[model samples]
Target: MLEHGAAPPSSEPPTAPDPVPSPGFVGRLARRKPVELLVAESGRGEGGAALRRTLTMWQLTTISIGATLGTGIFVVLGEATPLAGPAVAVSFVLAGLTALFSALSYAELAGSIPVSGSSYSYAYATMGELVAWICGWCLVLEYGISVAAVAVGWGEYLDELLHGTFGVTLPGAVSAPLGEGGYVNLPALAVIVLAMVFLMGGAKESARINTAMVAIKIMTLLLFCGIGFFGIQAGNYAPLAPLGAGGVSAAAATLFFSYIGFDAASTAGEEARNPQRDLPRAIMLSLLIVTVLYCVVALVAVGAMPWRDFAGTDAALARIMEDVTGLGLWSVVLAAGAVVAIASVVFAVLYGQTRILFAMSRDGLVPPVFAKVNERTGTPRANTVLVAAFCGLLAATVPLGELANATSIGTLFAFALVNVAVVLLRYTRPGMNRTFRVRFFPLTPLLGFGFCLWMMASLPAVTWAVFSAWMAAGLALYFLYGVRHSRLAVAVAVAGRD
Candidate 1:
């Protein structure tokens, strides 16, 4: 028997580590987060839970396609066609080329970086905190406003569906936004609410629903092309480029909104099962598929209808289907499909915005509440609810054209930063492992950056004004709050003190 006094002593349990300290104000803006650390933190949150990696490569591609295909072909085609005449097909091509260059850059960085912040995370790793914050702010404008813009477009198709199926349409007072002949847009608000409910469930569930909706959208557009081909007249093609080259450039800038979602998969990096390999494939594949479909549909649509007739047209695709087949049944079919299509856009884009905010919050740039993940659902529920409320209000009041242009400028700016980030990362981290790399090294990324600037310059002056105001607000917030709270800055300070 052992003596009681001779028993071995136990070790004291380790105490929890101290919370990171905040940094000083000056020069904190230029601090860069290490890429290795960012990668390590992928699915984790400062709020104490991990994001579930439930998305496969297939689901990722669907999210990208779902976010993109409908916004242009169903809703905004009418708006763009009148600006470029029959040569609107050329606008689609031009926009596709811009997207392609950017897509390659995105592919490399997504494979290398693989975080929920997308370009914002890339900039943080390669550039500095201030540039990354600017990129993230631009993303807020891009994804958030596009959701509202798409919701407003969805309301247009809902009106068409109502009239076709039941011979009743919502009155302007309830269906149109304020200052656009209506007091508020209830239908737009409804769609946002519906998407929010699905999002609250989980990302995997949403992706399943989106994939189904994307299939319906594609088949519907193809059906329209089949029937509308008979309505084409060669005379409709005569006045190509009625507004000339300047007009084409403008139309391309507007149409860039159509390609906005091709990068949606990049935002899902943390939620992807194998982000390094899958993210690059998902982005490039989705962009290629969408670009082909967009060009085909735009060519078919303009061939079937006169460009001038596109002006002031709501539910233009359904109107074209009805005219082509001389039956309400086809219009009903197209309208129903559009309802599904535009809803998917709202769903995917809203998901992207929430993820971006979650990333920022974890970095201590925004409030920690945004980084909080629900224990059961593996989602930032509060973030989703708050973003939905904001986007819903915007949908209920803002006009669609204004929302769309504002979105395009913000997207172009963020994309340009992403291109720059790629070149910078290559120079600094030459030995870092990369699953995907841009073909021409500096040339590819440089061209991508140039194309982004070209498109931004082509947007109207009013859009630039809106963008400048938004950037000013973002910078002010970053300096006042982000500077004081940044985790990287805090780490630097802690290291210095040690």
Candidate 2:
């Protein structure tokens, strides 16, 4: 509908990019994209490619659940249980509580903003362009690495399921990364490509597929509980607090990764049929469901055997199933469930990562080609392809151990910023139409920020170093390209002249 670079019908006309006339580098970088403009541009959809409204609260909730219930709960128990002993359930609760506070803040913002780009857009509106760029950059790392990591994990589980369920063998020397005893990890690449196919199919279709997969994952866990609960020895719980308060909190910090994906719900803000009401509900519903599932799994895993034996487990749930039921069949089922769950994670997170890039591209903060949506599919196929290809390459090359834990630190920083944006918006634009506001007003956001900071502090110094390097690289890129081409920056420059 646009001819010769005119703005979309409903949005403001972008300033013509003739030259970097008045405002030089520092002036341009200091410029802020007004909150009103962000709100106006968002309703026009990513830049101007209005996303199709397809997801209901149920579909949105499943995306969150499917993303959260991946390899974390399946494999992290071994690492966390040793630190918290039988009190690992308490650790799940603690992590869930921290994530819960952030989810509430996210609910408030998503309902109010109802836009894509997640916290990145929110920060741009409430904070400034620089902060937004950094936050978006952190998200890029968070999601890109996460998708690759999940794909790699999915490959391992797929190998297990194939060999166990059928009489097949995936030669690790051929199917895994060179550092991980394989040449290229074909299954990981395959899954990332399949995710691209699913995502390109459109949001509604992907949501339906994700819903079915999440159900399978949940049912598998339920089967584990139904069988494993019978083998519970209450005696194993007596010395539950053997690791003490410090240890339990430390374990809680580690367990925080398990609850990471509930925010993937917010990524669907623009796609939600009723963003104001549904976004908030989906966030709360998904968090509560995942929390309870995690706690129950922790309790069952600890109750079925000695907590000491949980350390160094490869696939915690599968091993627990075998050890508790003494049945190879149960173990195989759990392994298949893990494979399905991790695949869902890769799908949803990959979907989220692309949408984030699409949002950024619309603002001209990145290559504008990424913002182009496929008119036929009503999806951003180009962005999805770019993200999927890069993630696929990373998955095909990087070993799991080589993938840094910096993703979590990046996530925690973003959550903290989301909470800040919420507080600032509350004071700055108190009358904004927020269908779902956080309860307890300022208290909830403060707690959310505090919780995120505490967990971020718990990460290792090396993780912080890696995170800093990533942020620096992001700033460097922003200065080199983002500042000059940003639609908002051009608009601001024009406004100053006027």
Best by TM-score: 2
Instruction: Work out the TM-score per prediction.
Output: 0.89, 0.92
For model 1, where is the 10-residue window of minimal lDDT? 1-10
Question: Which segments of candidate 2 are over 4 A away from where they belong?
Answer: 1-27, 43-49, 400-403
The Cα error of candidate 1 at residue 46, in Å, is 3.6
Could you give candidate 1's per-residue lDDT for residues 303-340 as a string of tens digits?
A: 88898999988567777788888887887898898899
For model 1, the stretches where C-alpha displacement exceeds 4 angstroms are 1-26, 82-87, 177-183, 233-250, 306-316, 397-404
User: What tens digits encode model 2's per-residue C-alpha lDDT throughout 1-498?
Assistant: 001121223232354223233456665554555555655665344445667889999999998998788898888889999999999999999988888889989888887777778999888777777889988998887888899988888888888888898979898776888866778988999999998999999888999999999999999888888878987999989798897998899899889889998988888877889877788888889999999998998899899878998888867777777777677887789888998999999998998898788789889999987888777667888889999999999889877552447888888999999999999988866655567777787888999999999888877888888888888889889988998788976666676688
Supply the global lDDT for candidate 1: 0.85
